[model samples]
Target: MTKPLIIGVSGASGLIYAVHALKYLLAADYTIELVASRATYMVWQAEENIRMPAEPDQQELFWRDKAGVKTSGILNCHRWGDAGDNIASGSFRTLGMVIIPCSMSTVGKIAAGLSSDLLERAADVQIKEGKPLVVVPRETPFSLIHLRNLTTLAEAGVKIVPAIPAWYHHPKTIEDLVDFVVARALDTLDIDCIPLERWKSS
Candidate 1:
């Protein structure tokens, strides 16, 4: 049986990162377990001016259309408030978890073990289970508080994958930049969904 990987989308600004992540993962035929916070919906509206479907099942279709995926990747969308979901438990047996465009609030909550919702709870499960937890934080101009919270997670074996794109790759298009960061995030989990090339200095 192919183990699914958990993908958490918080209320972060860079929703595109999460979208690109889904595109890559789905194209690679990897099963995904996705949970997006209610804040994610709000952010999607404010950022993209499009209202994401509130229903989990509807959201699954929304993502599929966005990815334009022809591959057979399975996606299981969970409600943001569903704490009883199996992904919230360690026994659920996932490959690990990745929170793309991770919000500072989610980072702090997970760092303090204060899970108010499904996204946070699933992240907590990864920590307790000793499974890989990768967070691609998108906020900039980090204050001390944000740094401290991120540092706390890093100390606890979480991979703090930044959303910064590499210029060495000489990216010319916006998709190039997005894919570069997505590549970094999945690589942290050993997924290699994007599989960007390694840098070679001249």
Candidate 2:
């Protein structure tokens, strides 16, 4: 069986990026191991007006019934709440991991090697295992601290994909902008899903 891709959603403003990533990955028929921080749920509710249940089972039900039911591919989702989950260990192989809309705090914690939760621990495992680790941070007017921390992660082989959308595609909708960032994240993972128009020479 192909190893699953781990998707970690932290508390960030752009929850739609995470949503788009999940949808595209499912369409690509990649098994997903998903984990979201409590703050992520809160941000989702505040920004997207969607409430994600805290329990792992209920979270899966919510995604299956509401968020991802339309897709034909198997979700193959396994949700985990604790940091001690198997994916947190380097022994558990994965296709790699992406933290969509990664919060500044999440970036800092992961950069400092502080694995207080499953999201952080899983990312730590990815970095230590020499696997692909993409972090999509969604912050504006970044401070030096944020830049330094991000630089640290980059030096350690982490792909820092900020949630900055480009207008060269002449995006017509919010979803287009969201997909631009998601496409970049997918590209980092070597996932073959193009949700946006690639820049071409005129």
lDDT of 1 by residue, 1-202 (tens): 7899999999999988888899988888889999998799899889989898978889899888877774469999999999999999989999899999899999999999999999999999999989999999989889999999999999999999888888888888998999999888887877776756679978
Top of the candidates by TM-score: 1
- Once fitted onto the true fold, the runs of candidate 1 whose alpha carbons sit more than 4 angstroms away are none
Off by over 4 Å in 2: 65-71, 74-81
| Model 2 Cα lDDT, one tens digit per residue, 26-132 | 76777888888868878878986888887776776666555464654555333435777888899998999999889999999999999888889999999999999
What is the Cα-based lDDT of residue 83 in candidate 2?
Answer: 72
TM-score of 1: 0.97
Best by lDDT: 1
Cα lDDT, model 1, residue 118:
97
Query: CA RMSD for every model?
Result: 1.1, 1.8
TM-scores of the candidates are 0.97, 0.92
